[model samples]
Target: MTAFLLRKLGWAAATMLTVSILVYLALEVNVDDVAAKVLGQFSTGEQREAWLLANGYRDPLVLRYGRWLVAFLSGDWGLSSHFRAPVIEIIPARLGASLLLGACALLVMVPTALLLGVIAGMRPNSVMDRVVSVFAILSTSVPDFASAVLLSAIFVFWLGVLPGTSTMLTGFSLSELVLPVAVLALYSTGYLARITRTAMAEVMASHYVRTARLKGAGTFRIVFRHALRNALIVPATVVMMQVPWLLSGVIVVEVFFAYKGFGSLLYDAALNSDIYLIEACAMVSVVVVVLSQILSDLAYVWLNPRISLSGAERSAGVTDA
Candidate 1:
């Protein structure tokens, strides 16, 4: 596991470097002449050139990238053009809110998805199975933005039971997060439930499940202790993959609910053409995605001993000797 973690960390560093390059190039395409933009039409051409040169804008692209990379490594993520604050400082404040929202959404999604999946898989052709299948299909069909709007109308407008917008601070209660969390949870539950159901169904049909049943094991014990544990392996991987997806894809949901999360911050940065903030956001997102993939791979090894001994050994640092 130590060797495996080190390998993953190395890959993560490489991935971040690539992501930084891409983000830098993307931001470069946009107008980065902050001096020109801020100085305006009244400034003469020579004055603008002088200002740009003084700020090191005259440097080569490679030099600029090297400088940015060095600064980023040292915890200075550059200054935001719009907010006029360091990217590092602005990001962490919003990241906390995003993490809180993601946690709440996962809390609501995981158990509900697992329960529905297990029940459906236990009796494949039953009415409950059909109902769950239908719901899963419907849940995945609508996009998150539409769901957010529909939820807002029903829960906030019609029922007035939850706040339409969330003011998520350090001291904010969970009630402030309920509506946004529910929207995100409901949007993701269908996909996870379907994946779980499929995995569980396959496990239920295995020979060991039949043997356990024939040995007079109770249905709950046979399902939960044996089949469900193995069935959860795939779904758990899917759940881990959702971390990056939620982190980035929650932009629309966050915008709709006026929730101040990393997603919302990214959106604002893009709209305002804040290159520094955008780069920071993109880098953070890429890091999250790569780390999530690494975690999912490790989970696959941990869940299935056979896999750990076989294919996982090659890349996961598990030696045959």
Candidate 2:
């Protein structure tokens, strides 16, 4: 397990480094002059040149990349052109909001999906199963923005149950997050439900489940202990994969709700051509994705003993011996 963890950590580090370089390069390509972007178009040629030279933007691409890399390593993410603040400072505040929203979405999505899916899987061809299947399909098929709009219209406009906008004044609170969280959760629930249902159905039909049933095990024991554990293995992986998707894909939802999360920050940075801010957002996103994948891989190994065993262990006749 120690060796496995180390390997995963090493891969995550490599992925983060590669993603950072790519993000930096991508951000660099979008801007003609970072200093000009900061100073505005009204600045004269000499003024622009001086600003560029002073900020080291006039240096070669490699040199600039190297300098940026060193600063990033030392925890200085540079200044945001749009916000007129340090990238490091601005990112965390936004990230906190995003994290809260994401957590709330996950909290709602997991149980709802699991319950619906398990019921569908257990019943197979019942009316409840069909209803769940149709709902799952619709949930996964509809785009997030459309869902957000529809939800906002229904809940905020007509019902007045939840707030339309996610703009919080002093500090973060649950009320401020409700709409955004619901939007993301509702959109994601369908995918998770379908995956869980499929996994559970497969587990229910397995030989071990048949054996457990034949042994006269109680229905709850057979389903929960024998079946659900195996079924959850795959769904858990799918759930973990959603982390990166939530981090980046929430941009449209955030924009619609006027939520100032990482996704919104990223969208603003891109629209304003704030390369440093964009790069920071992209790098942070990449880190989140890589770490989530690592967690997924570890969970996979934990669920499947065959995967947990070392290659040498499998090759040797250890089990036979």
Candidate 3:
């Protein structure tokens, strides 16, 4: 367990380093006249040159990246070119909003999806299964923006029950979150449900389930106690994999709703060419992806300890060989 965790963490760190380098290079190569943009368009040549030197843009690419990486590790994410504030200082509130929305959406998504999926899976090819499949397909097919618009029109314009925009609310409220959460949940719920249904259906069909039934186990006992545990591995991983998708999707949802979450913040930074802000956001996103995957792996091991135990035994055998 210790070795496995250490290895995963090491790989995650390496992945982050690689991602940071690529993000930096991509932004640097694509963005033209960055120093001038940071300084101002009308700034004099000397001022631009001075700013570049001061910020180490004049340094070699490797040196600049190294410095940036070191500084990022040291909790200095640099100043936001657009906001003129440190990137670290700017992220928390926006991150909080994004997390709030994401959490609420997941809370709504997971159990509902799993229950629907279990029902469908247990009765594959039945009317309930077909209906669940259709709903999942329809939900996945709709783009986030279109869904946001449709939802806003219905709930906000037609019914006038929910707020149209989630912009700049001083504090959190479930009423304010209803539209955005629904939109986000709608997209992810479909994918998660489909995966869960497939996994659960396969588990239900397996020999052990038949054996349990032959042993006089009740339908509920076999489905819940036997099938559900093994079925969870794939669906859990699928849910974890959605972290990046959810993060990216939030940009459109938040922008459409005028929500000032991290996604909206990212959109603003990209629009204004806020290089430091972009870098910080990208780094944080990569970190989230890494951590989520690690957690997912741990969950899998917890669900099926034999997997990790076998893995460790294999490692030991290889070491001995």
What lDDT does the true structure give each of the candidates?
0.81, 0.81, 0.86
Model 1 residue 286 CA deviation (Å) reads 1.3
TM-scores, all models, native as reference:
0.91, 0.91, 0.93
Provide backbone clash counts, one per model.
0, 0, 0
Residue-wise C-alpha lDDT for candidate 2, range 76-119, written one tens digit per residue: 98888899999999998899888988988999999999988887
* Per-residue lDDT value at 283 in model 3: 92
Evaluation by TM-score, superior candidate among 2 and 3: 3
lDDT of predicted model 3: 0.86
Tens digits of lDDT, candidate 1, 1-321: 787778778888988888888877866633245555545546788888887677677788888778778988899887886788888999997988898889889999999999999898888878988988999999899888888889889988999988788855556867778878888898689888888888888999999999999999999899878998799877877888889889866788788878888999999998886777888889888887888878777877888766753366353432212
User: Which TM-score value belongs to model 2?
Assistant: 0.91
Q: Kindly list the per-residue Cα lDDT of model 3 for residues 1-321, writing each as its tens digit.
A: 788788889979999999999998977653238776677788888888887777778778888788888998999998898898999999998998899889999999999899999899997999989998999999999999999989989999999999988885667676888999999999888878888899989999999999999999999999889999999877777787778888999999999989899999999999998888999999999998888877767776777777764463353334224
Q: After superposition, how far is residue 55 of candidate 3 from its true place, in Å?
A: 2.9
Clash list (residue pairs), candidate 1:
none
* lDDT: the better of candidates 2 and 3: 3
Question: Which stretches in model 2 have alpha-carbon errors above 4 Å?
Answer: 29-32, 309-321
Error of 2 at 207 (Å): 1.1
